[model samples]
Target: MTNRKIYRIALEVEAFPGMPTTAAKLLPLLENHDSTASEIESILKYDPGLTANILKLTNSAYFGIPTRISSVRQAIVLLGWKRLLQVVMTICMSPLMNKTIPGYDLPRGALWQHSVAVSVAAEILVNALKIPDADEVFTAALLHDVGKLILGGFVKEDLQQIESMVTKGITFDVAESMVLGTNHAEIGGQILGKWCFPAELVSAVQWHHDPESCDESCNLSDIVHVANTMGIMTGFGKIDQELALEHFGPVADRLGLAPENLEDMAQQTADRVKKLMVSWA
Candidate 1:
């Protein structure tokens, strides 16, 4: 895990720039608090692929409705708008959200699974706290780790050094800085910002690991951070000796999430993830 290897991997990942979905049109639609079912269906209609994906997902293993859902309108009526929106967004994001970075020992779809679990966990946590705009909360959760696709190879290239630092209890962020020259959080933040996502969502992705630096108390980062740690421990994300237990308790305390409550939230979140994958699949 030398700088040379790290740079080499970073170059490969950058050489093949990703093409994410055109989300701006959908973003405003998602932001519409009072949007009707027809409105949501109309907005997604712009992308036939997105619409087809959603319909296919609604009939997937996750939802398993009694009848097939062959259209956006039918899916919306069957799944409810909130759940339908979640499925649509997941479909919209799936293409760009996938990659393999063996540095983290993540399998082909491992990172995607981890991200989905964490996103669902974050939303569950938000509901337990009765936070407002729960849809927006989940949206932020779903997109938080996108930066990892860009930086995972960089991290993988230096995997050995990262492992070495972890053995000595060094932080991933600190160890990465020492080896990779730039950290994933910074890279992730930059990507989100460049995409012109909601400023708050971008901020959460940027600062998820460090709750103190996040812009707001009720931000999605705090929720995602807790969800991510729980994902690792609960087996959604890959577990490594590199875990920083020091980070979790503080983040939980900051968000007024008690240990018992956090435990229940994690369980519920994992359950929902099972149902969620059906639609995504």
Candidate 2:
């Protein structure tokens, strides 16, 4: 629980391979209004496997595109640049995410399923609440818990102490910090920062488990926090901590979400995740 230990963990995160090369290159381009579809195509063309997966997702029932998408260009045009970026990131990150995390007790594919569910739930909240400034919300929710990948081994080493704190009524993440001096949410933010994601996106991952710590001007963290809770409620993610619905009241009120809204969102999230996972799997 020393700074040296945390420093070593930070070194490991930096050493971890970041996003796929092509996907990394295309992220900023897509975020820019001046960038062209052809530019995106140019980068993706080299990664035939990624291009094929993108096309596959576009044609998948989850997207609901009426026409077949044979090429990246066609998919880009139909899904628009932003949606295309989401699909590209999803496909690009799936391999890394679809793994077991011993620290959190997430089995192979469990983390991916939870990540996808949270992403879906985040968008559902956005539209339901009629919030307009959260274009990065989906990706933020998807990659929210990515820090588990790095911290799993360390967590397993200290699981006993962590669990003891949890039994005493401290939240799991808080226990992680008390025992490890760093929790998955904070490390996840570091991972995103290494990937060069925007500050808001990084904060969303950092403060997801403790939205109260997030800057008040940004609600992306609050959105992801609720979505993560919803993901656990739907039984998609690992749940090491006791969940208290009332704990979310303040964030819910800020988002204009009623208690009933969370229930409705949980149901809708489950249904959407079910269909998407069927096709995605």
Report how far off residue 131 is in candidate 1 (Å). 1.9
Write model 1 residue lDDT over 15-121, tens digit each, in one string.
64443454556556656657677777677777888777777878876676889877777886789767766776677677767667555667677777877887778
Residue runs of model 2 more than 4 Å from their true location after superposition? 241-246
TM of each candidate vs. truth: 0.83, 0.95
Residue 189 in model 1: lDDT = 66
Q: lDDT (CA) for every model shown?
A: 0.70, 0.86
Candidate 1 segments exceeding 4 Å error: 1-19, 34-43, 59-68, 77-81, 215-218
Error of 1 at 76 (Å): 3.6
- Model 2 / residue 126 / CA error / Å: 0.4
Angstrom error at residue 51, model 1: 1.8
Please estimate how well model 1 matches the true structure, expressed as its whole-model Cα lDDT.
Answer: 0.70
Q: Across residues 1-281, which tens digit of lDDT does each residue of candidate 2 receive?
A: 87877887888898989787887898899888688878888888789998888888888888789998898778877999878878888888999999988967878998899999999899999999998889999999999989989988888988999989888988888898898899889999999999988899999999888888787545999899899989988898767652434458888988999878788889999988887887786
Clashing pairs in 1: 62-278
